[model samples]
Target chain A: MLTPLKEFATDIRIQQMEEFKARGFGHVGGSLSITDCLAALYGGIMRIDPKNPNWEDRDRLVVSKGHSGPALYAALALKGYFPLETLKTLNQNGTTLPSHCDRNLTPGVDMTTGSLGQGASTACGMALGLKLSGKDSRVYLILGDGECQEGQVWEMALFAAQHKLGNFIAFLDYNKRQLDGYVTDICDLEDPAAKFESFNWYVKRIKGDDPDKIYETILETQKNQKDRPAMIVLDTVKGGGVKQIEDTTLNHHLNMTTELADEIIKQLIKQKEG
Target chain B: MFKCIYNGEKETKAGKTVFGETIRKMIEEDPQVVYLDADLMNSIGTSGLEKSFPNQVIEVGIQEANMAGLSGGLSAVGKKPFMHTFASFAGRRCYDQVFISIAYAKNNVRVIGSDPGITSAYNGGTHMPFEDICLYRAIPHSTVIEFTDSAMTAALLPVIKERPGLTYCRLSRKNCIAIYSEDSVFEPGVANILRDGKDAVIFACGYMVSESLKAAETLEKEGISTAVVDMFTIKPLDTAKVLEFAEKTGAVVTAENGNVVGGLGAAVAGFLSETRPTPVIRVGVKDEFGQVGTPEYLAGVYGLTPADVVAAVKKSISLKK
Candidate 1:
């Protein structure tokens, strides 16, 4: 069971790398950065039927950091949202998987998001709205560490905490990297978990690459209610899977060659075996 | 547009702007109209709504951004949400929330931004957003509108309800010049041709419709036939009508209550400059900040009065050669 699960996630990451390699350069840093988080959610946690996307009671997963489309698309394909072959057309001119996630175009995309710092707020609305209509549908939003600089994010955090939207689960890809450089050098997001807690949110931190921890945390989040919004800070490495692509100065977006893609695929295959 | 002579005032009614009233009616008639206020229910005339539908209304208390987000949520799951707040707060304060939460997500929510432009009165510069139109125009798929009067509001009410997308309407707190009568016409995407002429096109929107009409009258006195078009939908601007006027007239002038930048002028200029290179003069607040004064005084201060519209028309006519 463990071998197959790990293989499935690894295959998803390998496919993501291949697509980026096709484009020659995509948001490699952020895309690779979010693969495991997407793997865990779509793999085992989220109760989403790829065949029935508008399933009224289906849980929602919002990719607030839309630049990480490759990762989410890889996850969606593996989860049977669309044929796994469609993953190759990640950023084509007329493809469903745009550089940013668009609900209008993609079959299972719950919402369209390109502008940073607004997706989390909408997730709060989605979760709260579901609860209001007497449905138990949960919403999960993955926020970029770089996006925390936006003042609107805090406003939403304070709001979610104040409203005690327990049905909403927020994940912070605390990879310590952004578009330009490290998050601290860009703008210090000192202690995100503590910041959320201070804003009256029930926040927990986990190693973003650890599937077991991510899966367990997802279960832990289900118990939240009537107190504060839940936030899981996934402490991750930028450019997660491929070791070579992992910690560049610009740890957010990456431009790589076919040579790098081949080496990354080799590493993943070896990692799958070892 | 219809005009009623009330005490010889000759007021044109846009529609009865009863955002608070409509929500109350919806709550009583149907339990789905969820009214959310940013704690400005009394200020924005939502107090009566709260009394009628206390359970439906959520007073999120001073959190405009959150209120915007929450309202979008309420709308997503079959709850008709009317988020009432000041124009400045709704447009600028929670801009991202409106763009992503409501519009991008395709949530059925109505955003009523009261005290648009100089109408904020003594609330000063920070409150009165002379640039709200420009800010909202940046968001794609957003229904940005300004009711010429309460009649326009009432006419617009039923239309906004049936509309599936996100909508933002600016309501005048104090009564100004009404654009239509009690039972009149109101269309969101379609631009209303108040007056059509051949000499030049006078494209205007929001509070400036009356000013543009007066400006057309002023231009007519000078023997220049000016056509007046109320461009209510700034985003999907009525380019068909505007280009026709430009082709027939050879010159055009766009007047709006907001900044000359991304408001009606920018939209028209962007269209005609590429489609039909006709001479266009844009009369609006010249890329500057707002100031503390009365609405009437601020109009003059920002060059948004009838005089400015007339001057813009004359200048655009000169550029025709």
Candidate 2:
């Protein structure tokens, strides 16, 4: 199980890198950082039907930091939501895969979100709606640590806790970097886990790069969620798994020439084979 | 199917009360209909709705942005959400949320903004929103409706729910001058001609609809024939009716309780300028912030009374070629 999940994460990274290569420039850092969690969710954890993307009983995922749409598109395509070949058209003229997550254009994308912190609120709405209807399907929200600077995120945090949305699980990608600089330098989140806990949420912090940990935390929290929404703070590296991009500081968005993309892909293949 | 039954009297039930009743009925009939309020439930007379339908009513504190995004999420999951707040918060405060989450994202939701324009009364400048119509009108493929009376308010709530896309309903919380009978059904994008005349037409909505009628009455007594039109659905501006009146009368005056820059006045003038170059005068507030005052006092201050409409109508007629 762990090996297959790791392979899924590796494939997502490779596919997303190729998609970014097609665009020549894209949001690489944020997208790379959340690949493991996306792999775990789409690969095994989430109960979604690739055939029927709009099935009412399916679990929903809302990515608040929507600039990392390539990561989601890669996962969706690998899971057969759409043909993987469609990834070549990322952000091209009239492409279904936009630079940001849009539900209208993409299948398997639960909610449209681009303006930061909005997905948190929408996720809570979905959780509450499911709770009201007595449907046990869970809603998973992926938020950027830097995006937490938006006041709307905390507003949703307060709301989710107050409503006791046990079916909602939020994963905050604490990659320590945003567009301008490190999140601490820009606007320190101080202690996000403590903040959510103070807001009455059950909180946990975990190393985000491991798919095994990511998959296990979700299953554990699913059992222990007693009237409180769960918040899993992912301690991750910006531009994780790619040494070339990880070595670069300003990697939130990068200009990746085709040659550079080939070199990185070769390095990734070498690591996978070895 | 639209008809006018204005008899020169106030509506027995306030617009908010009628809205509350309609919301109650919608929830009772449909299990998917959910009503969300931003701590203004009592202000909009929906405070008691939660008691009867607790699962359907959500008071989302005072966070308008959250309320807007939450409604989009609700709509995505097949719950028809109707969010209400002051016009200030509903239109300006959470403009981006409504635009991106609900309208641009193609989420099915209905947003009700209470106390539009001078109807906000003592809530002062911060509470008054003279630009909500303009804000909502700019969104791509959005329905903007301004409720003129209790009958219209009651009649249109269900229609808005069944409509396919995003909708913004600007309403008054208090009583309005009666403009339609209880049985009068309304379809959006159609004009309700209250009084017809060939001399000139007064296009109005909200508080100005009754004021325009009064102005038309005064114009009729002076042997100058004038028409009064309740242009309730402002966005898809009854272009057919506007063209008919503009061609027949060769003169037009728009009256609104809000600013002339982007309200009914702007819609009418902008359309006529492109379609047919006719004489048009806007009777509304001109780039001014609201202040704490009675609706009547503010109308006097902002020149929104019948006399003002009458003056604008004469000015429009004088400019006609």
Instruction: Give me the candidate number with maximum lDDT.
Output: 2
Tell me the deviation in Å of residue B135 in model 1. 3.5
User: What DockQ values do the models have?
Assistant: 0.40, 0.82
In TM-score terms, candidate 1 sits at 0.85
Residue-wise lDDT of candidate 1 within B75-111, one digit each (tens)? Answer: 7656788887888888888887888778877888888
Worst 10 residues of 1 chain B by lDDT: B5-14
> lDDT tens string, model 1, A164-246?
68788889999998887778987999999999988888778988987767878878777753456788999998888667777
Docking class of 1: acceptable
Per-candidate local distance difference test: 0.79, 0.91
lDDT (Cα, tens digit) per residue for candidate 2, span B1-321: 656777789988988899888899999999999999989999888988887887899989989999999999888888999999998888888898999989888889999998999989898999999889988999999999999898888889988988867899998989888888888899899988888999999998889999999899999999889998989999889999999999999989999888887788888989999999998999999999999999999999999999998999899999988
**Candidate 2 C-alpha lDDT tens digits along A1-274:** 2388888888898899899899899999999999999998997889899999999999999999999899999999999999999998999999999999999899999989889989988888999888888898999999999899999998898888888899999999999999999999989998999999899998989999998889999999888878999999999999998988888999999998999888888877766676
True contacts kept of each: 0.55, 0.70
* B270: Cα error in model 2, Å: 1.3
